[model samples]
Target: MKSKNSLIPLIFSLIFFHSAEAICKPRGFDYIQPSSNASTSTSQQQQSPSPSAPAPNQVPSSPPSTSTPISNANSNPPSSEPQPPSSSSSSPAKTFTPSPAPPPTSSSRPLAGINLFNQPTPKTEPTTVDPAVKKICDSTDYPTLCLASLTPFLIVGKTDPVSILELAIKASTQQAKLALEAATKLASAPNLPPRKASGLSDCQYMFNDALDNLESAMDAIPSKDYGTVNSMLSAVITDSETCEDGFTGQSPLAEFDDKLRMMGSNCLAISSLISPII
Candidate 1:
């Protein structure tokens, strides 16, 4: 019985060994190798990109960031295009028109304070005479004498009627002054006869009257009093004629006679010219 109990313990020991042997045995190569290869492949799949994914060398494409700026620039293209034209249209200064200049007017009056007597007589004949001068001269009793006397004054372009009358009165006064000087010289002559001295003294009185009348006529011209001018000029003519008549019956003071006759005739012509105006 003791020996049987010892065998029984050995049998339990053998059974435990066999079970350990079975539990401790290595796995098959196929199973371990296939599992290792599958694990390696799974790690490679996780580490590397798929074929459909982008390459490492290529950059990833997303919606273009430049599109927003490009769209904003294009949004107001028409608005920017019409700004220059609107600014140009608002300015009307480019279409300004200029005004026309006024026409010049002609003057009828003579230059003031011109002295006809001091002015030199023109050597050459004028191409034309004023119609007003011709009309005034023609109205005189001695048109030829009036025209000839006034031609020297009119040639200077002083065409005013008042200036013409002033010139005539000045000429008449000058003649009277010359006649008075001649009479005074004859009256003062040594060894003078009574009859000759009497005629010369009468001539002096008549010349004084003529000078006074001519001066009065000159003063009347500025007043536009042609009637008074006519009366004074008529008196001048009468005084000159009376002076010439005083020398007539005597030896005829030839120089004094000529001057008195010329003075009387000029005064008569000037009076006729003023008659129509009066």
Candidate 2:
């Protein structure tokens, strides 16, 4: 009976040993742990739970809990590192910068060629007659009459000898025409004396000759032939005097005598003015 009891205890010890071994040993498909040296294994065996304790599946679940803290640590580091780059980029965008305006070009200004410093000046012309012409007119026999007669031409700024001679010829022609008309009217008048009628006829012939001489002088003036012009003008003066002489000592005839004397004197003065210029 004691031997049987001893056998029972031995069986119990074997069974217990087998259960502990099964619990401690790693299964083929289970997670592999780091290999431990003999001393570390002996310490781990002493701290291990008995075989009757719960299965170690709960311990394996603890590794995922530990990995949660590791994931959080990695996530935090990335967030902190990227924050500076984001802040720097945002700060640059917030600052304002404007583009500069364009400079003034040549096309913008209108008066590019106009000069402000130098201005244009106005032109002026002469407005008065020369003094030398007045001196020549002063030397005439009828100085005041000659100057007054030539005033219109002188104001035009031309007082040459030919112009004076032309003016004198025109005056003489007008006087001769007046005298010829008077003589013709007198000669045709009824109840006139024979001497008075003869004198009027003679006056008409002399005035006709005076007009012809003045015309010849005018034609010679353009050719600048002073000698021929002077001779013809002298003949005009003589004809005027002769017409007046025919009426002199015959009758009153004051009007005809005054006209003939003026015409002769004007012709003589014009011929004298022509002498020096030629």
Candidate 3:
């Protein structure tokens, strides 16, 4: 019995030594634990129902039980930072220009004076009178005697108004005297009536008066005595009218009235130059 007990203790000692050797063996990990307590704690944490595998909301406090410790890894340099493209400002808008205006044109024609309507004018020329008759008839002397001789007798029995005949005779006698006086003053040839025969003497005398009045009127014109000239002409016209009336009906009255016609003819002749008197 003593030997068997001793052998049983020795066997127990050998089993214990082998087990210690296996538990204490080194691994590839750099870290090593002094006792099994850290391993046991990890194993118990992993196997103790693992807190029902912790819901997604559960928190864990312990560090990881890794076979090797964690180490930081080298990182690649950051890619060159791309700069945002710079925004450019807009340029100013363009300006515009305008064109000039044109001027007005002028007319070719100028304004001037011109008579559009053309017409005719009469010829201005002097007319001739019998100088001998004009010289004697224009006088103013013996006006009453010369006026008495002329008569109108266009009708066979008609007689002129004695008063009108007297006025004509008075005017002619004075004209006759004036003519003789004018002739003497001008030193011109005297135009006197020749003494007539019988019943024709008064007619000749009146004719002589007509001649002197006309001459006297012409002479008066140079003296600017237009009134005297005009008066003489008026007297002569009156005398002729009286002669035409008084001799209209008498025999030889034609010859008597002819003297008055001569007086009017003389006035018309002078009127050519004296026409402006009208």
Candidate 4:
């Protein structure tokens, strides 16, 4: 009975030693852990269940409880140790360098092309002028100026020819009056140059006369006195030219003076068209 009990204890010791040695033993690894873990898993599955076997989740732990005591004993140099590789081998078995920590992303600035002041312009279609306006303006000294001045106004009674003559007189009258006012202001300025002062004074008188002529032309249009209207309007060209001729360089009143001359020309031409209507 004593011998049987002693042998039974020895058998249990051997079985425990083998089982712990197999679990804790490290494979000849190549700095990788997956293959070793796979083999270990397969080996664990094949083994029959013993009450002393480790749990499944504990399989991937770095070192088991059985390895701690053995590792301390084998810590001495191999020449002095003469230990089983299972204890010391676990340290160098598997290594993974955590994939170089995925290269850092570069930062970017906000977009510089955004426009806060985006505004659209209003659209305007070309003005469609009357043929009578075109015809009347075509006969003038400045047809473009004539069309621009005369095409915008309408006659109360007549749509075209009568309206053309009336608008012509009206345009000349307006431009000449504006010229006269601007010239009068310049003439009154202190320390005015001799030639400019003389020119401005002359322009003032000429524009007054031009306005009077435009008034007479407006009066004649109702009576269809085309010849008298032509004579009066044709004289306005001479008046504007005579005023401009006094100035050495460009006149201060050039804007008004030049436009008045063109309008005078437009009046003369439109009036000529109405001579046969008398």
Candidate 5:
């Protein structure tokens, strides 16, 4: 029990000692607040604008920013210059000095005596039959005979009929020659072929008929029997064509063809002259 009482006093003493230590601690710490106030006052003094701030505002009454004079600046903007006129109006109008036109080159010159600038081109020099051709016409009547007789032979070949026919036509003279030439050409035509039974009998017949008519024609000319000559020629022509449908290649026909052509030029020449007389 005594020990318990002493223990109680000891606890009370500890409580009292704690209370006094707390009071002393507050007394020692009270000085720190004043020091903190002093530091706050020093900060305020450092942050405040000094006397120099008002002096800068007060010293700047010299000139406004906009009113300042600019140095080394252009007074005016650059301009474009006007161009001079090509021709002066006061002076006489400038003459255009045109280069002279070159003369016609030799290559451009007209053929023969024809002048490009002058007289209406002499009607293309009337395409006269060649002298050689005229001589053929004048020499004999056989030229027509040859042309007429040979047409049958030619037509039997594979060459173009139109061109062959044209050649025969260009060589033809007199009614008999023309008829014979036409008949032979048709009978012997390449396109027509050797369809006849007698091997170009029609062509041969026509050629023979032409020959007969021409003979009769020449004979009649002496007597001035123009009618007989005409009749004979017509009959021969008809007879010659009658056999055309029957023509088939045969009978050494090539020989007869050669003979016919050999004599045609001479025969045609004489016949042509006689025909004009008739």
Candidate 6:
């Protein structure tokens, strides 16, 4: 009885609020309801995907991104399609065969290089002084002396008795002149006895005679006068002997005198071999 009017106004306000709230709310088309008042509610809300985020099952319209391959120097590349090897890789490299060198000829020889074979040097043969040296020396009185002295003077193959005799006389003449010089020096001594001084003087004169005879024989030998050369060389030996006899006991010129006679004997012997060169 006291508040009937206030209750009436409160009931009007609640009805107005429910109507206005329903009109102002945005409608969700995603969900469908069988009745307006009886709406179906779930524990989780199912969200529709945006344009930026794709679903797991959906395929991309554009191509997938490709990854770049890493290169390694030591690693071998994998072969594709089980391919057969090309001719360049599978075949052997070409072999180089050098041409054989030409044989060495007399006209053209290879240049000298290192002596790999260690070849020995060629040996030279020994040679005699002359072809007729042994034959001529074997027939002389002093064969060793005659060969030794005449071998240096003779031609290789020539043999003439006159020429041999001339060489002999020349050798003998040299020895005789040496003796003469010795005798001449001895004879000029200041305090020499009359006997030794006279003997030395005689030796000098005899040696001079022997040398003159030998020189004459050499001149006569070129003309093939073997008879004159033989006589002259024989006188040369006699002159040397006479010089030796002038001294009594152990003469100072005994060695020279003996050598001169021996040389004179060789000249005499060689002159006898001359056959007049007809």
Residue pairs in candidate 4 whose N, alpha carbon or C atoms collide under 3 angstroms: none
Candidate 5 lDDT for residue 73: 70
- Candidate 6: misplaced stretches above 4 Å? 1-131, 155-158, 276-278
lDDT string for model 5 (1-278, tens) is 99999999999999998798677664445434336658955545445465334333243324434655555575654448865666754776689999999988856765432331231111222233334333443354443443333344343332332233233333322333434444454455565444652445556566766666556655665576646755654554355345443444443233333333434334433344445545
lDDT of each: 0.63, 0.62, 0.43, 0.70, 0.46, 0.69
Q: Work out candidate 4's RMSD over C-alphas.
A: 22.5
Over 110-155, each residue of candidate 2 has an lDDT whose tens digit, in order, gives: 4433332222221221234356555655565555454544444443
The candidate 1 region of ten consecutive residues with least summed lDDT is 113-122
Model 4 stretches with alpha carbons more than 4 Å out: 1-126, 155-157
TM-score of each: 0.46, 0.46, 0.24, 0.52, 0.23, 0.51
Better of 1 and 3 by TM-score: 1
Each candidate's clash count: 0, 0, 50, 0, 28, 0
After superposition, the stretches of candidate 3 with alpha carbons farther than 4 Å from their true spots are 1-201, 244-259, 262-278
Flag the better candidate by lDDT, 1 or 3.
1
Model 4 over residues 168-224: C-alpha lDDT tens digits?
777667667667767777788899988788888888888888878878877877787
Residue 130 of model 6 has an lDDT of 52
lDDT of 6 by residue, 1-278 (tens): 54988888888999998788677556874444335444322211223164345456654455556777987979989867787778678677789999998876733643233221232221331245454655665677667667655654666445666667667666777667677777877787799999899898898889888878988888886677777778888899899889878878988887777777777787777666665343
Candidate 3 structure quality by residue, lDDT tens digits, 1-278: 99999999999999998789768666764434446667855655555556646435445555445576445567555569886556685656878766665543323322121111111111231243233322322432322222223222122332222222223334344434433333233233255323212223444445466666667766665565656666776666665444345332452434334334444433333332243443
Ranking by lDDT: 4, 6, 1, 2, 5, 3
Give all candidate RMSDs, comma-separated.
Answer: 22.8, 28.8, 38.2, 22.5, 24.1, 22.5
Highest-scoring model, TM-score: 4
Q: How close is candidate 6 to the true structure, as a TM-score?
A: 0.51
Clashing pairs in 2: none
